[model samples]
Target: MNLALLFGEDFVSAEQAVLTGRRLAHLKSVLKVAEGSVVPVGLVNGDIGTGHVLQLTDTQATLQVELPEPPPSPLPLTMVLAMPRPKMFRRVLQTCATLGVKDIWLINSYKVEKSFWQTPWLSEENLRENMVLGLEQARDTLMPRVHIRKLFKPFVEDELPALLKNTHALVAHPGTGTPCPVHINAPATLCIGPEGGFIPYEVEKLVEAGCEAVHLGRRILRVETAVPVLVSRLFDACS
Candidate 1:
């Protein structure tokens, strides 16, 4: 973990926190931190700063925290993605958070398996865990919001239009006429399909809902691969 992400429960007082579990193990085995060592620390959805080790033991480590700096700026983007395979979901969500994507929508597509939503990774606890991993990797503290929509048409017809308001909306689809724009660096809403890409009807619905269909060249990419490429191409805000 690049940064120790502390939750409200991890704090004992305004400036003190006790680390246990994975964090304590990381300090012991990976960092080999001793008393008086200062480590990078940040509170979840709060600030980025440092923590001075006040005590270190086998079970727990106490730190005096100083949160003086704000976290990195988030990307002005909202990601609307078709649900991917269970095995790849956690990695994709973490990657999105790491890339500074603050709003994510996991919607159903024709190619998406019904069993995909059954994955434990979609649970609130598991989602937060994976997001925390991503935040730590990026040294960011702002938590990303994940919205799940199992019914595709209702989401597209009812919700997506308002979500696209005042934003450059695009759907990444292979074989499309328009190439994906680069470095728009403004608020945008991007919709990506599953492994096989969205079916014609679904693409039509999204386009009708305000997204301009665009392509990322002839080579079709996996959802995980396309996420980073698309986000980077659309924005340069990520550090």
Candidate 2:
């Protein structure tokens, strides 16, 4: 539940804040929060607090709350992803949010299905919803900024450099190399390909644009799968 939405007069303590919105119902019905319970409380863009249930009425609930420790910072990576199918896009967006990507670019690719572009899930509202789900799941409030690029070369040759001002740029491709290097101390820009992966020409253009082409071994993973794998593997390597 969003702490900003909690309302009432007697909610003086962290335990007295009552929730009456959809979240309250979810907790009472699904989570089975009982009277005198203390649950996780958080501000919309602030630290997590404790919600102590002082009273529970059919229409309202109260708690005592305070925001203490701050939420963790976002991962220092900018993800450049080729637009996948609509369903795939939803998953990818959420995953990117949970992984704390600094930014996301939904770029066009040579292998991108023309019909996939027509999916309504690409609409702003739908995309935002997926990102919210991802943030909530990860206990993160900040949303990653997202971009769209329908053209390939123009984006790589023109816009990418500025976007990646101080970031180390890398593109995820399949083959052999030292494997995507472990997370470095600095921020990074990672480019992932379309379903069948980036064509050689597309890869070459990106390489010329200052992004190093890196591999994840021989196994070609789906776009949705490659993302988290790369994020964790690279970050863990550096950690």
Candidate 3:
């Protein structure tokens, strides 16, 4: 963890906060902080700053915090993703957060397994935990929002059009003729598919909803690898 992320519950007063659990372990083991040591800290959805350790112990640490600097600007991108395999979902969530993607929609695709949605990682607590890790890694405090949509057709037909409004919309398909645009540096909505890619009918629906089908060359990448590659390609700020 690069920055210790503080939640509302961590605060005892306006300028004081307490750390425990994983963060305490990190302080003791990884950061090796002492009573007078100052560490980087940030409040969730708030600002980035530093915390001066006032007290340290095996179980908890008390710190005096000052938050004056705002977090990094969030990417003006809305990510519409096919539900990935349960094993890879956590990593993808972290990647999205680290890349500064503030809005994420996890929708169903033809190739997505129904069981993927059953993963515990999708739970609110687990989701927050993974996103927190990502935020800490990036030294960012603004939390990303994740929207779940299990029905593909309804999402595409009823919701996606509105979501794509005033944004450059594209779907990343493997064999599409158009290369994914680079450095657009503007608001965009990007759709990515599951392991085998979206079925033709699903792609057609997304196309009808306003997304231009685009590809990332001939090389096939796993969802985890493709997400960062596509985000970096689309936004120079991320690179």
Candidate 4:
């Protein structure tokens, strides 16, 4: 973990916080921090700063926290994604977070397996955990918002229009004529499909909802690979 992400529960007082579990293990094994050492720390949905270790032990560590710097600016992008395979879902979610995608929509697609939604990684706790891993990797603290929509048609017809408002909307399809735009660096909504890509009817629905069908060349990238590539291509300042 690059930054120790502190939740509200980690705080004992305004300026003091405690670390345990994975973070404590990281401190002991990875950082090898002493009681007097300072480590990079950030509060969830708050700011980035440093924590001076006041006490250290095998189980926990206490630190004096000071947060004055704002986290990196979130990407003005809304990601509408087809639910990926259970095995890849966690990694995709983490990638989205690491790319600074604050708005994420995990919607159903024709190729998406129904069982994909049953994965434990979709649970609130697991989602937060994976996103935390991503945030800590990026040294970012702002938590991303994930919206789940299991019904594809209803989501496209009812919700997606408003979601795409005032944004450059595009859907990444494999064989589409339009290449995915680069360095737009403005508000955008991007839709990506499952392994085999979205069916024609689903693509039509998304297109009807304001997304322009676009492609990332002839290569068919996996959902996990495509997410970061497309995000970086569209935005200039992810870091």
Off by over 4 Å in 3: none
Q: Quote each prediction's TM-score.
A: 0.98, 0.83, 0.98, 0.98
CA RMSD of all predictions: 0.9, 4.0, 1.0, 0.8
Ranking by lDDT: 1, 3, 4, 2
Model 3 weakest lDDT span, ten residues long:
230-239
Residue 219, candidate 1: how far off, in angstroms?
A: 1.2
lDDT of 2 by residue, 1-239 (tens): 32223333435554445466666786688667777777665554456656777668888766667667565577888899999888888888888987777589989999998887788887888877677667666766666788888989899999998877788788998973747887674688899999888999998898888888889888899989999988887675322
Q: Estimate, for each residue in 1-239, the C-alpha lDDT of model 1 and write its tens digit.
A: 89999999999998999999988999889999999999999999999899999999889999999999999899999999999998899999999999999999999999999999999999999999999999999999999999999999999999999999999999999998999999999999999999999999999999999999999998989999999999989987545
Error of 2 at 209 (Å): 1.0
| Residue 6, model 3: Cα distance from true site in angstroms | 0.5
Clashes of each: 0, 19, 0, 0
State the C-alpha lDDT per candidate.
0.95, 0.76, 0.95, 0.94
lDDT tens readout by residue for model 3, 11-75: 99999999999999999899999999999999999999999999998889999999999999999
Candidate 3: the clashing residue pairs are: none
Better of 1 and 2 by lDDT: 1
* Model 1 misplaced regions, further than 4 Å: none
| N/CA/C clash count, model 2 | 19
Error of 1 at 52 (Å): 0.7
Q: State the weakest 10-residue window (summed lDDT) of model 1.
A: 230-239
